[model samples]
Target chain A: MKILIADDSRVMRQIVIRTLRQAGYDDHDIVEAEDGAEALAKVGSESPDLILSDWNMPNMTGIECLEALRAQGSSVPFGFVTSEGSAEMREKAANAGALFLIAKPFTEDTFKEHLDGVIA
Target chain B: MSTTDTGQRRRGSDSRPVITDLMDEDTILAVAGDAWISLVGEDEVLVPIPGEMPGDVLSSWVDVVGPWTGSVVLTTGRATAEALSRALLRESAPEVLDDEDVEDAFGEIANVVGGSIKAALPGPSGLSLPQVGHSPLVRNPADVCRVEVLWRGEPLTISVQGALPPLPVTH
Candidate 1:
C-alpha cells in the first residue's frame, strides 16, 4: 500500500513514519510531501492508497487539500495527524470527508487503535 | 449621550479577554504533562515544581490568533533543547546535532503543546507555524498564564502570553 504523509515539520514527518512502523504497518510504501499543496499534487502523481496529513500547513491546508481532492472527484482515504484536535476542527475535518484525526503526541498504540482496519 | 444607537454599553476595544480568563495554570500543566508523555517518551514525567531557568535559555513557540491572540512560548536551557532534539530524533539522532535540527525538533514540541492549549481555549482560532528563538514579549501582565516545570530535572517554562499591549486604562 502506498501512504502519503504531509507535514511542514521534517521532524514530525519522521516521527509519524516511525510511529507507523512501530504500529506494525511497516510494509506499506511511504510518500512524503512538505506541504498540503505538494500533497495535493502528489495525490495525482503518486496515487497513494491513503493520506496522512497535518492540519496546519503552509500554502493549502490539509483540509483545503482534501476539499480540492473531493472537488476533483478523488475518493482517496484521508486522515489527519495534527497538533490541533479540538472538537470544532474534528467536526470540520469530518465534514470535509476525513476518515480520522490523530492528534500530535500520539503513541504507537494510538496509531494501532486508529489504523487497525484502515491499513489492512 | 455618546452611546451608539443600539444602546448597549460599548465595551472598550481593549476589553479582550486575557489568557488567564480563558484557561488557568492547572489546565496548562495538564496539557503540557500529557504532551510530554506522548511526545518526549512514555515514561517521561513533568514535575509541577518550579525551577529557575538558566541564563542562556532558548524559546520555541506557536502563535494563537482568534478570541485570544498571543503566543504559546516554551523556554528552556540550550542544553535541554539539544537534549530534547536528540530525544525526539531517538535512534535517528546524529552523532552531533546542528542548530537547525534542534530548532525544528524543539519548535515541534511547542507546536503540539500550543495546539492543545488552543483547543482548550475558546476557539475558531488559527495557529501559526512554530518558531524558535527569543520568546515573544509579554504584552500584558494580566494576560499571561505561565507554568514552570521540571522535565528530567531540567527547568522549562511554558507561557501563554498575549501579543497586543495592554489597552490604555480608562479613567
Candidate 2:
C-alpha cells in the first residue's frame, strides 16, 4: 500500500517516516508533501491508500485539506498528527471525516496503537 | 535627556536580574524529558558545568514584552546548534547551518520548551514569539535572571526577566 505523509517541518516529516518504517510498514510506498496544498495536488494525481498529515501548515491546514478531499468525494483513509490534541480538535477532525488524531511528541508505540488497526 | 527617558533606561538595564534563584536542576531535567524525549530519540541525561554560562552555544536574543519587560535570549556555539538540529531531525549532523536556519530552529525550540514551562508555572504569563541573534555576545543587563542548564551535556541557556501571572489574563 502507498502512504502519504504531509508536514511543514522537514524534521517532523523525517521523524514520521522513521516511525512508520519502524512500525513494520517498510513494504509500503511512502510519499511526502510539505504543505496541505501540495498534499491536495498530490492526492489529485497519485491516490494513496492513506494520508498522515500535520494540522498546522503554511498554505492550508491538514483539516482543510481533508475537507477539500471529502468534498470532492474522495474517501481514502486520513489521519492527523499535530502538537495540540485537545478533545475539541479530535471531535472536529472526526466530524470532518478524519479517522484518527495523533498528538505530537509521540513514540512508535503510540503511533502503532492508534494507526495499526486502521492501516492493517 | 529627560527624567522619563532616564527611568526607562534604568528599567531596561535592570530588566532581567541575574537569576540567582536557580531552577532546580532536576525539575528542568524532568521538563526536558517531557518535551524532548521523542525528538531526542533516547533518555536524556543532564551534565553539570560548574561555572559555564548556558548561552555559550545556540546564541539568539528575543525581547519578552507585555506583562514582563526584558529579553529571553539563548546563545550557543554554532557546532552545538547543528548537533541539536541533527538530533532533532534524526539525520547525520550537517557540516554547517546557515545563520537564519539555526536561529529559526533555536527559536522554535525555545518557543516549545518555554511555552510548556509557562503553562506549568503558578500563574498566567504570555510568551512572545522567539527572535534570533547570531552575535556571540549577549547584552543583557546584570540584573536579569539567567538560568543555565545542560541537556545531555549540551549547554542550554534560559534567561527571563519581569515576573507576570503564570497564565495570561484575558481582559
Candidate 3:
C-alpha cells in the first residue's frame, strides 16, 4: 500500500508520517509533496492509494488539489490532516468528497479512528 | 453617521468584540498545552507559571482574519525555539539545525495553536500561512489574551492580539 502526504511545511509532513507509524499503519510506501501544486502533479506520477494532506499550503491549497483530482476523474481515497477542523472546514472537506479530516493536536488514537476502514 | 463594519458586534458595548471578549488566558494556555503535547512530545508539559523571557527571542505566528482579526503568536528564546524544532523533528533531527528548520517547526506550532484559537472564535475565518521573526506589535492592549508558560524550564508566551487599534470613544 502507498500513501501520499501533502503539506508545505516539511516539519508537518514529518509529523504526519510519524503519526501514521505510531498509529500502526507502518507497512505502506509514502510519497511527499511540498505544496498542493506538487501534490497535484504527483497524483499522476505516483498514483498513490491514499492522500493525507494539509488544508493550507503555498502554490495551491489542499481543497484545490482535491478539486483538481476529482475533475481529472481520479478517485483515489483522500483525507485531510490539518490544523483547522471547524465544522465549516469539515463540511467543506466532506462536500469536496474527502473521506475524513483529522485535525491537528491529534493523537495516535485519532489517526486510528479516522484511517481504519479507509486504509484497508 | 460613520460606522465601520466588523464581522461581529458586541451586544453590550455596541462595538466590535475583542480577543478578551471571545476568549481568555486559560483558553490560550489550554490551546498551547495541547499543541505542545501533540507536536513536541506526549510527555512534554507546559507549566502555566509565568517566567521572565530571555533577551534573545523569536516569534512565529499565524494571522486570523474574520469576526476578530488578529494574530496568534508564540514567542520564546532562540535556543528554546531550536530545542522545540529538535523535539518536533525527533529521529530526523539533524545534528546542526538551520534557520529554515527552526522556521518550519516553530511556525507550525503557531499554526496549530492559531488554528484552534480561530475555531474557538466566531468564524468563517481565514488563517494565513505561518511566519517567523520578531513578534507583531500589539495594536490594542485590552484586546489581547496572553498566557506565559515555562516549557522545560524555559519561558514561552502565547498571545492572541487583535489586529486593529482601539476604537475612538464615542458619546
Candidate 4:
C-alpha cells in the first residue's frame, strides 16, 4: 500500500516512517509532505492508498486537507496522528469522515493495533 | 559495581524527581532520543556559548499555567539557529542562519516540545505561544519554576507552578 505521511516536523515524519516500517509495512511505499497544501498536491498526483496526517500545521491543517479531499470526492483511507486527542477533536474528525485517530507518543504496537482493523 | 548499586547511586544524588519519577523513563528517553536525532540528522550539535551571546536569541517567554506553573523560553545561539534553518529547509547546515530564521525555529521547537509535554501530562494544561526575546539571557527568575533533570546522561528540565483550584479563576 502507498501511504502519504503529512506533518510539518521533519523529525516527526521520520519517526512515523520508522514506526510504519517497524509495524511490518516495509513493502509499502511512503511519501511525505511538510504541510497540508503540499499534501493536497501530492494527493492529486500520487493518489496514495492511505493518508496519515498531523492536525496542526503552517499552511493548511489536516482537517482542512481532509475536507478538501472529501469535497473533491476522494475516498482514500484517512487517519490522524496528533498530540491533542480530546473527545471533541475525535468527534470532529469522525464527523469529517476520518477512519482513525492516533495520539502522539505512540508505539509500533499501538500503530499496528489501530491500523490493523482499517488496513486488514 | 552491580547494576542495583549503579541505579541507587544515580537515583540517590538526584534531588528533583518530578519529571523523572512522574513520567516513564522510556517515554523520556524516546523524546530525548528523537530530539537529538532530529537535531543531529540536520548536523546540529548542542554547542557551548562563547563570549557575549547574541541579543535577539530569545524573543518571548510564556508561563505554563495549569497543575504546574513555570516559564518556557525560546532562544537560539548563532550556530544553533543557523543549523535549525538549514534543517527546516532540508538542506545542509548553512555557515550562518539569518536572525529571523533562527527566531522562527526557536519558537517552533518550543511549541512542539511544549505541546508534546502537555499531552503527556495527566490533566489538561494551557500552553502559550513562543515569545521572542532580544537578549539571549532569561531575565525573569520567578517565571522559571524548575530546571530539567539530567536523566541517564541527557539534561531534561521541568518546572511547575501551584495547582489550579477546581473552578476557574475569574480575573
Where in model 1 is the C-alpha error above 4 Å?
B1-7, B10-14
- CA error at residue B4 for candidate 2, angstroms: 32
TM-score: which candidate is best?
3
Which scores better on lDDT, 1 or 2? Answer: 1
* Candidate that would win on lDDT: 3
For model 2, residues B64-120, the per-residue Cα lDDT tens digits are 333334444555566666666667765543566666556556655554455444433
Ranking by TM-score: 3, 1, 2, 4
lDDT of 1 by residue, A1-120 (tens): 999999988889889999999899999999999999999999999999999999989898999999999999999999999999999999999999999999987989989998999998
Residue pairs with clashing backbones, model 1: none
Best by DockQ: 3
Per-residue lDDT of A53 in model 2? 95
Q: Which stretches of candidate 2 lie over 4 Å from their true place?
A: B1-31, B46-51, B54-77, B98-147, B158-171
lDDT of 1 by residue, B1-171 (tens): 353456355565536898888999999899988888777788888888898888999999999999899999999999999998888888888999999999989999999999999989887899999999999888789889999889899999999999988888764
Error of 2 at B138 (Å): 14
Angstrom error at residue A92, model 3: 0.4
- Local error of candidate 4 at B133, Å? 8.6
Query: What digit string (tens of lDDT, one per residue) describes model 4 on residues A5-38?
Result: 9987665676678778778877888899999999
Q: Report DockQ per prediction, comma-separated.
A: 0.81, 0.27, 0.91, 0.15
Rank the candidate models, highest DockQ first. Answer: 3, 1, 2, 4
Expressed as tens digits, the lDDT of each residue in B1-171 for candidate 4 is: 334445555554343223333445345334434443443343333322223434433333334555454444434454545554466545433466666555555555554445555555544556654555552333333323333333222232323322322233334
Per-residue CA lDDT of model 3 for B1-171, tens digit only, reads: 778868476564476898988998888888888999999999999999889888999999999999899999999999999999999999999999999999999999999999999989998999999999999999999988898899999999999999999999875
